[model samples]
Target chain A: MFPRPLPEEKPLQRGLYVGFVALILILWLLPLFAVMLTASKTADEIMAGQYWTWPKHFNLIENFQAVFAQTNMWGYFINSLIITLPSVLLVLVFSTLTGYVLARYNFKGNALVFALFVGGNFLPAQIMMIPVRDLMVSVGLYDTYLALIIFHVAFQTGFATLFMRNFIAALPDELFQAARAEGASPWQTLRHVVIPLMRPALAALAILTFTFVWNDYFWAIVLTQSDAVKPVTAGLNNLRGEWTSAWNIVAAATLFVAVPPVTMFFLMQKHFIAGLTMGAVKG
Target chain B: MSELWKRHRNWLAPLLFIAPGALLFGTIIIASSFESVWISFFDWDGVGPKTWAGLANYRELFADPQFYVSLKNNVIWLVMFMAAPPLGLALALLVNQQVAGMRFLKSLFFIPLVLATVTVGVVFGWVYDPNYGLLALIFNLFGATAPALLADEHAVTFAVVVAALWPQIAFCMVLFLAGLNNLSPDIIGAGRVDGARGWNMLWHVVLPQLRQVGFIALAVTVVGALRSFDMIAVMTSGGPFGSSEVLAYQMYEQSIFSYRFGYGAAIATVLFAIMIVFITWYLRMMVRLEKETR
Candidate 1:
């Protein structure tokens, strides 16, 4: 609407705009298109310089199966799930409680505590990298799934709390007042009233947190070493090293690593966008 | 017992709610950050005992040639990444149209964002492959050879930055799209009545309203550019003798691969010091905005 509708434009100008959009979209997706095509091709076809050609033989199932069967891809995939799910749940619970208290209470140090959470969210991971690793090593949790899970839950709580607090703050105060008038306890009010209303926010945060922890390569590499505990992101890097010339297998594995997050994004596209653009847009 | 519970619940409830989050953030993020800074003053290989060597790591870092290269690459990333916001604005305007199939088109554009940066890096690395890459294929059509982008010292950083820009630009576009959706119809109607159309409308009316979104986009982009590590690590590993290293990756390499924990902490501290400037500005803006909302 701001650019003026294409219908209001001259026919030629409208055509040009459509064409330009199509061009950019094609250019933007070219690499991914290549990946998809390459993933379906055989190693012979790929090595024969038929990179752009449609695969003479479709090897999709075989290539993907090989990715799982011939490598540590399965272990990596399970590790990712093991790391991501608990982290998401933990972050949601912790941040939801923190957000609820911050939004509803006028306690001492409320603003300072809120600021600390928000500020901690912005610090570079490198700043905390050495000490966090040392702490994990000292606790004998290095190269384990728990290390990544714990770190993610802790770090993600900052952003999740910010999001949850803002969301809870925006809910009508009359709801709380009505609950209080009914002689309901604060815990009861939260469980019965706020929890139900927080469904959308929770969905958004869950998907975002899952995607974040799933795709975390830095912590995966830092904390976990062996294939036994390495998530897919870092595992994919290792696979790349192992399968240097086997681009098809690597491509298949990359798509496999990407599937969960991509599915979540599409399934919850609206909430995903809402979660990401929460503070960017003014009311 | 019930009377005591009622009396304490007011304070107790909030404290209980805040405690876990505060404890986690304090120990993991805050305490670790300070510990890292403290560790920067000592010489340690991370397994053995740490020896107090005040400022020795910093002095070495100041003289290290790789540190300068990483710093310069970081500057390049910052400058290159500035293109995201403007490009994102352009894409937002384009796709913000209510044309047929626009939703599908918009979703298609968002595909890269759903993938991991590691995925993006590996895919782009193949795309830039000189022997059998998409770039090579394109060059073949034109009777020219494709340069091995990730292999070249001069082009590796640019190559990695471009891959990182893919998702970053998409992110900015999403931000601008949200901003564009929330633009007031009344203001646009008024501008239309005043003969504001085309560049006149965009430059004076549209862009002015997009100031906050633009600011957020810029800040996010700056922070992202500064924090870039995954793409470089995946694509090049700062190869060709460390030509493409940024400070984050350099810090990781120094600490983890090279067993220089103290030196890595020094690099982390410097990166933190640089980031605190942006963090302060971002927080100030956020606090002001929060105040306005209240």
Candidate 2:
């Protein structure tokens, strides 16, 4: 009571923190602004290279048409959906079931299998790049969407399993024991008991896996070949071929293709993030 | 004993559980990852008969400074990568509210995380453009100069890391928001009633609750930092005399570009070993925490 609260403390410090946050946010958004502006700028303006400045003339429609014309950005977008959707579903379903098994069952190799998942999660993608690619080719799945999907589903399982298992294991063991006592078949127990209890976890897994597989690139590049099989991530690189100087087209293309996941994130950010950091502190 | 064993020998049940996931997991992830080690020993150009070079690649890597630079960058990334946790918490607190358009703001902040590495790389590559790029134009607007972030030896790696940090920070924010949202408000209200205000509330109550979330964020971020590849590949391609190289990038450079498959595998093994250390530590800590909770 001796010292009166400063009138500006709430506004100033919070303001300053918000300001600090805003400044960084702007920094975060700066490249996007460049991409947007450059995308709308005309070919002549781009050649002049006044990228950050306001467009003398906006031509977003035409520029996007050109981008689509050149890169088939939509085709790649569809390819991304094809690869991402199945992989994501596979991750959610498999990781959930596997996590349930590991969480409830104190079977042998429980620790070993869990450790295997951990180590698998940490292994660099590069080490597996050559062999994975060779395997894909040998198996005749090379240059196919299946190559990308299978690899994404398989590797992502390591992390996703860790996530789903830790989360499921945190649930009360009484539930599992109760389910077992009720004569719920293993499949029935998983479906009725484990899965129903895992709505949030399943939601979490879906959005996380969707974002990851949606944004995946290293494997996209390694596993698939040609524009026929390539996703939007790799297609953006293909956009850089000769029209590389066409910053407008590149920007337009980038912005166009970036819409799906960005929209998904904005829409389901809470669940998306919860899924991402589930194992961060603990695992 | 025989009856019990026979009763438990419903092999197909376990096999069904193990098949789809284990088959794909084993053949693709586990086995294929090690296959590189075997292939690395060969002088095969990916097309011809293999010729094994037991330790030749490892020697070359030991002598290569690029490998050292990449390793050093990895060390830098691992250390600095921890910034995600606190920074994320602070950011979540900043944006987690009932304000108008908070949802929009959260998504806006989250855009970087959603975009592919190719987009991030190319976008930053342009943003760091020395001539007429966005950053350069801003510098000129202020009547000063800007360095070529991608080309300048001093700033190249730093710039790339900053570019990488954009998505990474977004990632951290995601976790923190989740942590904050799930926090026990009853405990928070009790503390507030007990005059736990501001920093005390945050430190004594919030941070402790957030510890679980914090570890998850750190694990992902650390993995993100170490597992970086697509961005490096798309952005600078390990440019400015390889100042921006990291272990993953080096592994790719060695195995694919320079055709030093064996050396690349060794670098990967080293990276794997380092990651395993983090994994084990994380597991031990998590397991202990769970035990204590029980």
Candidate 3:
């Protein structure tokens, strides 16, 4: 209605709009399509200069298998899982509790504390890189899975708190009052009442946090040094160095690395969009 | 114990709940940021004893040609990335219609956003590969040759920025689409009655309503541009002799690769100083919104 719906448009204009949208979509997805095509082709086929054509040989399984068997791709994938799962869980626990407290309690320095988290979330990661690395080294966490997990949990808590606080705040206060009237302790009320109600928010945060931690490259490189603890993002960067001219293998590895987050996004599209666009829409 | 619990629970419960998050954020983010500023004044490798070097790193950084190159590239990224928000608004308007199969098309456009920045960088690296790349193929079709974008000092930063713009535009489009959904139908109806249509309707009526989302898009784009490290690291490694090095990548390269903890912290401090300006505005807006809701 804002731009005059296509139904009200002249036939010629509608057709042109459709054509234009379709063209833009193709251009937008062109690189992804090229990678997918390259991922399915043989090294020889890629070298044959028919990069855009249908593969002379469909080597999807072979290419993917080679990416795993030949490199530390599988190790990195497992490391990502190790790093992402506990990080999401820890961030959730911390943020949920923090959000609940910030939402329900009126206290001294509440606004200041909330402001700190909000501002900390937006600060460039570079600012903390040196000191955090030094801190990790001093604490003997550098190059360990724990290093990445701990840093991610702490850093993500800033954004997660902001999100969860706003979400919990929006819930009706009557629910809390009713629970209080029933002689429920605050912790009990949170466990039995708020937690159940917060499933959607928790799911949204989990999906978003999982994708974020999984795709993290900055801390991955800064904290971890070897394939023993490196996540897929850093591992793939390493693979790129080793497999420079092996375009087919690199393409296959890229897709393999992308699968988890892409699948998560597709499966949880609604929550993903909601989590990401939370502040943009309202504030 | 029971009496103590009963009496103090009112204040204690909230503090108990907030403790873990506050502690972690304080140590990792807040404390470390200040420490980084402190570290900038000392010369220390990861394993070495600290040596005081007040203003030496900053003075050297000011004279470093690489710092200037990084600063220039960052400006280029910031300027080029301004295209994303408007392009995103255009895409959002185009796909926001009730047209059939728009959902699938929208999801297709969302692909790059789902992929990791590293993956996106690698994919675009291939697409820009001079020998057998898509760009080369397109040029061959036109009876020309494609330049090796990542290999050229003058073009590498722009090439990487364009790849980054792909996902950034998608992010902005999603934000604008959400804004569009929240638009007041009454205002549009009123505008229609007043004979506003086409460009006038979009420019005057719809665009004004999208100011908040547009502001968010602009801020996020600015932050994303400044934080551009993974792409540069992946695509070119700030190569062609560090031509594509932005501040973030330069900082990382200096600390991790060049073994200059003090220098890296200096770069980080500079980047932080730039970010604090934006962060101050962003936090003020958030706090004001939080107050309004209360």
Candidate 4:
């Protein structure tokens, strides 16, 4: 209301304003629109330098077939699922425990532990790349799915713990007091009080972590080299190298790679934004 | 065992709950960070035995011209990325109204943040493609030729940064939208009663409440800029001629392709040193904010 909402009675002015904003939105998403357009075009049209025109052949299905046929995109997509789902699950499990302890327990070194989680989340990934790679290699987990899962779970726990800790801390303290009075143990309190209340937070965290782990390209290259273990982001980059001039096919592949996370975002926009703004707007 | 657990569950449960997360984070994130710093002093190919090279990597890093270029490009990323928060705030304000289908429109605007940076980079690379790109199409309409942005050494960093900024701006907009929603209705009502409207109302009344969210946006943007590597890799691969390399990508190039893990660790250490300054500032702010909320 700070900008003063338009009067509900002023249909003409409101319609014009909405129309103007819609126009700007189109301009903003023009890049994505162009990609979608390119994805529908035939390879022959792309080679003919017809980027913006309507696809005469509408070869989207053929391009989709080419994406699956010419590359291991489906396998990479499966690998991404194999890596991402477990990483997200582990992050949630670990961070819930960590967040609960930091939020409820009043033990020594609590602040330091909290600081470590918060600070570690902020550090650039390159700072730890070499040692992590070496550690994965030493453990014989290199070029495997577990390497990515373990590293992602470990790294993402830092941020997830911060988020979950803040959220759990903000819950009404009287609930804990009541639980304590009822002779409920910490586990009981967690199971009865925290987990049920954490469904929304968990949902948000799950979506955010899924998007992050799925989109990770750096560690994919550093820890895994085989096409068998590589995620779709890395696979998409590999396809970029293989199909340099086939923009239509590459564009189609790009859309394929983006489908999962974008679908999740649209499906869970509320939770996604809630999770994002939990840290940004509040703590 | 059951009897003992009943008695000591309070003290023991906290430890059990914290151990897995703490251990994993300590070993992988904290320990690896320190180990990389330690590795910077040794000469190793990441596969061979380490020879104590004490400051050799750093010395070479200081002398290497590509190191300077990378450092300079990092500065460019840092400076250029500062635009996200303001532009994001503008977008948030533009779309903050409660209207029909606004929710859908808002979600549409957030599409970029959900898309992979690799996807965004590839799309933007096509956008910058000179011959058959969207830019070329636009320029052709005006009878002007488009510049091949990703191939020009001077322009490649800017081009990649622009692509990276697409998602970053969406992120900041989400933050600001949340901040706007949480603004005090009472204060806005009071401001309206006082006849404050438009920019005057925003500057004097609303802007003060947005300071914390703005600070968070700024910190996130700075961190995002420093962490810029994936886009560079997908788009330019730190080219043309390493002109677009930031410290993160340069470290990857040195360690992975060149097999100079020691030198890469040194570069990582330098980047860590720079980030420590911001990290310290960010931690302090967060700690202070927590205290204020408490």
Among these predictions, the greatest lDDT belongs to 4
- Ten consecutive residues with minimal summed lDDT in candidate 4 chain B? B285-294
TM-score of each: 0.97, 0.89, 0.96, 0.98
- Clash count list over all predictions: 0, 7, 0, 0
> For model 1, how big is the iRMS in angstroms?
1.3
Candidates' C-alpha lDDT: 0.90, 0.77, 0.89, 0.92
Per-residue lDDT tens digits for candidate 4, residues B130-199, read: 9888889899999999999999999889988888999999999999999999888999899999999888
- Model 2 chain B — which ten-residue stretch has the worst lDDT? B5-14
Of the pair 1 and 3, which is ahead by lDDT? 1
Query: How would you order the candidates by TM-score, starting with the best?
Result: 4, 1, 3, 2
Full candidate order by lDDT, most accurate first: 4, 1, 3, 2
- Checking candidate 1 for backbone clashes, the offending pairs are none
Which pairs, if any, clash in model 2? A279-B216, A280-B215, A280-B216, A280-B217, A281-B214, A281-B215, A281-B216
Off by over 4 Å in 4: none
Better of 2 and 3 by TM-score: 3
Residue B81 deviation, candidate 1, in Å? 0.8
Q: Write the per-residue lDDT of candidate 2 for residues B62-125, one digit (tens) a residue.
A: 8988888998888777777677667766777777764334566666787887888888888888
Assess the local accuracy of residue B20 in candidate 4 as a C-alpha lDDT between 0 and 100.
Answer: 98
**Tens digits of per-residue lDDT for model 2 on A250-281?**
88888877888777876776677667666553
